[model samples]
Target: MTRESLCRLDEKPCDVELRRRRQDWRRGAEAAYRYRQREEHLDVPYEHVETVGAFPLGRWLSDQRRAYRAGTMTGERAAELEKLGIVWDTADHGFEQNLAAARAYYDLHGTLAAPRHATALDLAVGQWLTNVRRPGGLGKDPGRAQRRAAALAAIDPDWNPRERGWTVDWQRHHTYLAQLLAEGARLTAVVPGVTWHGEDVGRWLATQRRDWGRLSAEQQRRLGELGVRKAPRARRTAAKTAAASGPRTGGAAFQKGLKALQQYIAREGGLPGRAVVERLPDGTEHRTGIWIANQKARRDKLDQAQLQALADLGIEWA
Candidate 1:
């Protein structure tokens, strides 16, 4: 054979072809390179096997694709899937595409269909549905919007978009939520007839402001950016302030016990034990030894002022 016709391994005749095949495989190209290798008896170092005998491979791959679309399947998992010949279209079209699809379906058919693509986008669409429809707007594909459901189901047979997952796209969801909420949109706007925790954004915001400490740091930061500042704590009224400043009942109880100790020390010439302290009180006969013991056991619970009061009496606590 002539130099051009003779395919030499040293000349790397398949290098460019192999690179092209790798690109195709990465893009999920169906043409099998392994089958070609077998047919031609090509001594290619790299072998491509279509199926690893992974049952429900389609669904597994589909979920991974959906995750990649939602921007959640990054890092090692994504790389591992790539190694398995699953290529991810890295550009995030989930929000934009799903939003457009939702708006189109709503505009065309006058009903809301949750995006079957990504959970984050679906949530966003649900939020939007809340705004357009009042108190109870177009309830989710209420007539069992078969066309919309079918379209999504075709992509994923188990396309229960509302079903919760551990790996939710929180950042995307929050960003979309913050944007929609800032534009005077409510959660029910997307999820028609459903109030988040039985309240709209306005009511929720008021409650959130009232219970700011319960919120996470990320939530606080996000809400802060959205101009939802925690309201300053209400100052106590003069009467309330005076009541708070009044002598604690606990101090009085401690003082009564201290006075009994002093009397016992003066009268009996010894520190009061559990028996002595219990016997000193009028209601003491019914009280258990455990209850009397607990008073001494809980010495640390006393306020510093109460401890100081005991210290001034030259009574050392055990």
Candidate 2:
């Protein structure tokens, strides 16, 4: 064979190999495109495999990322991936995804004080926020962490409850109350059994008032903004108030029933029978079973403290 023909044969093999690699890359790109179409994102998990072609798209993308970072990826290939919304830094991508979830939650609830089990946009946003609120949770880089914190603060200024000298639960309750007030709900109108986002908002509000002295200055200030003040001190003594209010006073009756229920539970080591009656120490006859039933029936009329009293006594419905 002529020398020129031999060189041409070698060139042909190299061209064929190049063509094969290009075809493989195109197939992976197709799979990636499909995934983006379905999920509207290219933030595929490391273990994810595209189902349609059973393609290891995630690994392929990882390879591309490594190549890009190593400065080996061709400009054409990088441009193609970028067009598909590829994010090279998986960690940053993950953070963005979680941020999106946080935004969604804030939009719905008006705050980021989500419970540990809360989910938004199919993401465990509550847990994510909890983690991110921890010291150094954003990342080791100070600038990055600051930026992330700013992003969260944009959603709700009190996104980190601990930083504000309170627990997430307390922040959640406060947020709920603020939301109600903004919606034109009066403080008195938010009584026991009033709930918002599964939280006993009325009960929480009552607790804040009752324990007003126990709260920090900052907490009190926040409550004050919502017009929630310390519960009023009675001018009359308990005995006089009870006597003046009469024996049929709702609070007094509830207390009597609670006392009787407690005594029964202590003696019986369980809930009282629905039909059982018990006499109080003062010889006041209380149909304890019927009273319990009535309490459950009138749960909405009960205040936070009253509900808590029942709950402490093992009343599940409370």
In order, the Cα lDDT scores of the candidates are: 0.46, 0.85
Which candidate number maximizes TM-score?
2
Q: Which stretches of candidate 2 lie over 4 Å from their true place?
A: 1-57, 234-318
RMSD of every prediction: 21.5, 10.6
Looking at model 1, report the run of 10 residues with the lowest lDDT sum.
188-197
Q: Model 1 clash tally?
A: 12
Query: Per-candidate TM vs. native?
Result: 0.22, 0.63
Kindly provide the TM-score of model 2 when superposed on the true structure, using C-alpha atoms: 0.63
- As for candidate 2, its clashing pairs are none
